[model samples]
Target: MNDFERQLQELFNEVKSMIMMGNKNDAIDLLQANYEAVNEQINAGNKGIEEVAILDIIALGYMYIGDLKFVQSLLDMMSGIVDSLKDDEPLLDAILLHMGSMYSTLENYEKSMLVYQRVINVLESRYGKTSILLVTSLLGMAKVLGSIGRAKKAVEIYHRVITILELNRGTESADLVLPLFSLGSLFIKEGKAVDAESVFSRILKIYTKVYGENDGRVGMAMCSLAHAKCANGNAEEAVELYKKALRVIKDSNYMSLDDSIMENMRIDLAELLHIVGRGQEGRELLEECLLITEKYKGKEHPSFVTHLLNLAASYSRSKNFVEAERLLRICLDIMTKTVGPDDQSISFPMLHLGVTLYHLNRDKEAEKLVLEALYIREIAFGKDSLPVGEALDCLVSIQTRLGEDDTKLLELLKRVLRIQEREFGSESEEVMLTLKKVVSYLDKLGRKEEKFPLQKRLSNLRMKYKQKVQY
Candidate 1:
């Protein structure tokens, strides 16, 4: 390293030591002092690699402190100096990499991709294409592509990374797990479940060979495979795998009982169990989750809200509206206190409570809660969004039970039909059901002109769907 770079490294070592010693303010002061000194040199027309190095270190200090707003300004200054330098500058690679990562963190994906590509070019010129040095930049680029919804391109980049790793460190090397796992997750997200199942199956085999069957990593891989199986329509096998995975992970103690990872796994298994007609088992798991979070995170923690909601759903499914209402109120209170009443999250519990009140024959109270939920969802997700559509559906039912105006009910039904058509195509069964509802409403409103076309459309949909089912 150059003299200036060496001095910069030493200064950062001291900064790190101060931070480790809990002298965070003292470290910030030191960084500020060095930053000012560097600024003075730059202002005096001493703009060089040394000045860039100083600024980069100070920016990194602020980044470590999570003061990204200040780091952004420092990066803006560095960008000007770095742009003036050639691609072959000695410190260019490191500076570009840092900038690429920070830009990604700031959600400036376009700039992040630009710098990451530059770093890849510089590294490829220095070391050949398959060099390990290229992996970091390639992964960064892949992440940016994934963030921007370019899934096919991201999958290609991940495959390239896997190829490079296998070339350097054999196909079975543990190093393959990171990219393989990422590719599998992307496949699942894209609903290519068969592909995801194959990828996750290979990951499970790799982990078993490398870490042994009882290793926590293997258990983790198995959990992923189970999810893929579930997505691919093998619920029975998936349930068995989830049960085994829970046992292995707990036995290994790699994740503590109350760790968020373990907690989430239990919740996932619970939801699946509930879906598979094991509601009692699911309720037990939900209760366990509630106790664990309440013990470790305290009763009013936002984490408890999820467990309460799940249990309430379980009770509601069993027709226990009283208990469900009680749990939902606690959940609603916790959510309102944590994120305030206007947050979109509050709408979920409000809708649930509204439905629960409706089941209890309290139409007035149900109407009030559902109307509030509809207002909140409309503000958060826009009027035509699916969440708003859901709120409208609930409001329609409550209003119908309360014997509201027929004209108003017809409007709500028409809006719901429009939303359903937009979301699930005109030919979808969901749209067909809404079309039937709309037709019924039109008949009640004495709109025979509108009713005739919808009745014909619903008839066509039923015939089409019946033929497909029979085939």
Candidate 2:
């Protein structure tokens, strides 16, 4: 190798070793030093592929440290060089791949998708269809598409990638795993839980065949399957699958599994348990998960706030409103400081705290918090979203308990009904519940004329629900 190449390789090794040793700051410093040295070399007329390679290494290090600004700077520099080296297809392709990944990391999905598509077009035009080089760009494009809420398009691209991999590397090859996983996750996001379950089951079988039952990948697939089952409303079965997945993970070597992954699995299991009326068990598991997350990730980390939210949910499920309120406040404080008060994430804790306050007979405080949450939800998810419906439901309950006038409550109920009907259909249990509430308020206000029609609608819904249950 040339001197510059050798030096870059040595620097890469050093940075990798430091990162593996858990000395991330040391790694960053080493990378930064080498990056400046490469810049000096480039300024001294030593610029070439070696300089680009060094920049790539530095960009990767910055990415590891979540230093997106530095990463973006490096990406821009690389893009300029790649533009000058348009004839060098391999180098240009490599730079575009990194640029796409960096844009994705920064949540610039549009730019990421464009870069990936350019890479794919270049690779396909040069090497023809079904080239292995297209896999990376295709996968990147699929992920960006999914991130930008184009799940169907993402799924199509993912399937295309899977087909190419299966044709080139065989069905059971590990190369198919990632595309399959992405496809399954997209299915889940699209609310196609049955499809997700099928995909995950296939993945579980593949992992089991390749790495045995106790492999961490197998455990992860099991967890994915469990989530699909839970989404499908098979909570009891999901609970069993989660337990099995946890056992597999725990039985594996500690080095093979990430602590954060285990923590997330525990959280999922706890959530399912809570859904199945095992609130105490779920609460204890969440408490354990919270302590571990705080110890490892620190209290200010976003994951720590997520654990706190999950634990608060457990507390609320167990009727410990005081504890739930305290935990929600902590989460709200952390999110407000870290993500700002106006972030959509804060709305969840606000809504939860509002519910807890309502249960505690603090109607005024509950109303204020719920209104704030509703405003945030409306801004973030629009007026017809399920989250807006939920926030409105909480607000209506608080208003009803506060003895608000029927007119205001009626308006709120109608809004809730419209949202629920749009989301879940008129025959849904949610619509039935809202209809009953609307009827009750109408009757109480002595509006018998309006109450009769709502009562008739409620009766029809009850019949539909009964017939559905019977069949």
Candidate 3:
């Protein structure tokens, strides 16, 4: 072998040695040592395994180790090879898409977004926007964006994908289910259960008829249904659906399962387990989910935060307050540092922390945290936002426990009802449910003079919803 080939082979051996010796830092250093040398080899017009083969192995190394820094270095090394393939659109598109994949691996979604834009710019401009590669690129970018908290943008892109798919195949075609799932996930994140249910229902029908009810995809769709049902406040039904889905997944083919999909299923099933109050099962599943996520995305990632927050809630419910409190505080610190103290993302863990404290009969501290979360959410999502209603509901429940017979409590309940109605429409189940709580508050106060109108409105509302339910 020549100098370049000799150096690459030597470096590869060194990397494997470092990893085997449990000296990852040394492995990174070794990769750093040969970084420029590898680029030189790729540029020196080598056509053997030392160039493309070495580069591919190095990329896989960074990816499998799940180190953001090493993955970035691997990407930077690939840039030289890409620069030489400027006129080769296929190669360029593949390179750009691969960059998107790496950024996705790191969950650096904004960077992944820019990489996808490059792919779209090169491919669509060169081969026309109607090409199948363009469609796939758009869908892939949408998926990444959705994963990284840009659900609105992802929803828009999913709609465009749906439009393209529909134009090519029409609504009755199996292609509809793909975009339907994307939209369903987008709706789920935003707490739009009704919309999500509709999309998942469509996907379920198509997937069942096309792939059979016993298929893994049918199971996946059932998982989505379970989540939506949970969001709709039907946890018992969600638990049943999850059990059915789990059975199907366990029996069906595992070869088709991707890591991301499997991780999601793990989380969804864990959440359902929690809904059924099987805290032990949920905690075990969440722990396994965390291990897989840590292997794929590393620690201190938002998804890491998500799983921790979720499990902490389970811990609190299982009466393990200390562990729950520790996780919540870490989450609080991370959210404050990353998104700032006032950002809405801080509200979720805080809300749970407050509720957990309340469950432990620590009302005063719970009130403080819950109010802080409510204030932050109101500032971020407006006074009439559903996020505000969520915090308000938490506070109202706490107030009921504290035996606060104050007008402020009633006013807060009224505000929650108004916000839910404003955001989700007056006939929405969430609005009706909030109104039910308000009626309960009035009932406790024995203010029939004030409660009569609410009682009548609720009866009418109940009738309306009951009729809708029956039909």
Candidate 4:
């Protein structure tokens, strides 16, 4: 090793010794004190492999101390040197990985992906395919893809990385846990709940063996498993799992308690409870979550908007339409400013607000808002989507309450039924519900012939459902 390398080694030894002696504050101070001198030396023509080594050591020190701002500054400085070290491929790769990680930490996922792809290309050229060195870049790419809503692509990449790690390491390797967890989450997003359940079960097993059953990581896995269970229509089991997860989080030491995680889990549990008819309990939990979220995450944060909307839903369930409308209006204002008027994110709040308004006897305003939400949902998800069907139902309800001419309401009901049939098939519960609405509207319009066909279809679907359930 050269002079810079020798110095870095000494610093590393000193920092490690300080940590061993429980003098982490002193170690951080020493690293901070030496950082500027190292940078000045590099500026004064000492920019070699050892200079890069020194920078990496300093960056690691900042990371150890959890000072991400300093870590970002050090990575930015290293980025300027990375291009000049083209001949030093390994050093270039390391610097690029550091930069990518910093970018990811800052939520600049697009830039993170660009840097990670470059690292992947360099590693592939240097070491060929199947190299363990490609693992980090692959993992980063998968994460960026998932963040950007490319769930299928993210799943593919995650599986590829898992296969490589399992082959190069072992089936039970710790490295497989993260990818498994990510894959499970992606599966859930894609509505593959059975697949998600399988992946999360594996993760739960791994966490149980490695970290013990009561670890917070195990709680996370259990929460995910609970989501899958809920999706699979086992609400009681899901409720139990969610409660168990919360218990693990509650039992954790105070310093180890993650407020954001705890709040999110509580919100999820509340939603499940509401779905299972425990509206009072669910509403109380939602109110608690909303308060905590507003206190820490701030009222304007996206997560705060989510909590507000969820609480509004609970209020709506409890027939507290006035409070529901107030909360939903706040959510709409925030969403409009953050995501713009026409974004798909605005649709849910608009629809909920419209429903609340309709309940409060404001049909005209409710109709306008519901129409806007319908337009947005149709543009984002097409006319035949489930969301569009829901929007149509809202419009139908508003028009019916206004006592409008039966023609338009009847046509709207028919359209909703068609959309449901296309999306869920004629035998599904969604189609059955839409068919009933269509029959009611047709009968009110004195179109007995039109009602006859829908009535027959509903009867057949109910019989089919009963037969399946009985068997």
Candidate achieving the largest lDDT = 1
Model 1 misplaced regions, further than 4 Å: 2-33, 66-73, 320-322, 329-347, 362-365, 368-389, 414-435, 450-471
TM-score winner: 1
Which stretches of candidate 4 lie above 4 Å from their native place?
1-214, 224-241, 250-264, 342-344, 375-386
lDDT of each: 0.90, 0.85, 0.79, 0.83
Q: Write the per-residue lDDT of candidate 1 for residues 308-373, one digit (tens) a residue.
A: 999999999989999999999999888888899999999999999999999999999999999999
Pairs clashing within candidate 1: none
lDDT (tens digit, per residue) of candidate 2 on 119-145: 888899898789887999999999999
Tens digits of lDDT, candidate 4, 274-393: 889988888888887777767766788887898888889889888999999999988988988889999998999999999999999999999999999999999999988889989999
* Candidate 2 residue runs with Cα over 4 Å from true position: 1-4, 16-48, 89-92, 121-128, 253-258, 277-471
On lDDT, the stronger of 2 and 3 is 2
Model 4 clash pairs are none
- The C-alpha TM-scores of every prediction are 0.83, 0.63, 0.48, 0.55
Q: Per model, how many backbone clashes are there?
A: 0, 0, 0, 0
Cα deviation at 313, candidate 2, in Å, is 5.1
After the best TM-score superposition of candidate 4, give how far the Cα of residue 275 lies from its true spot, in angstroms.
3.6
> Weakest 10 consecutive residues, lDDT, candidate 4?
249-258
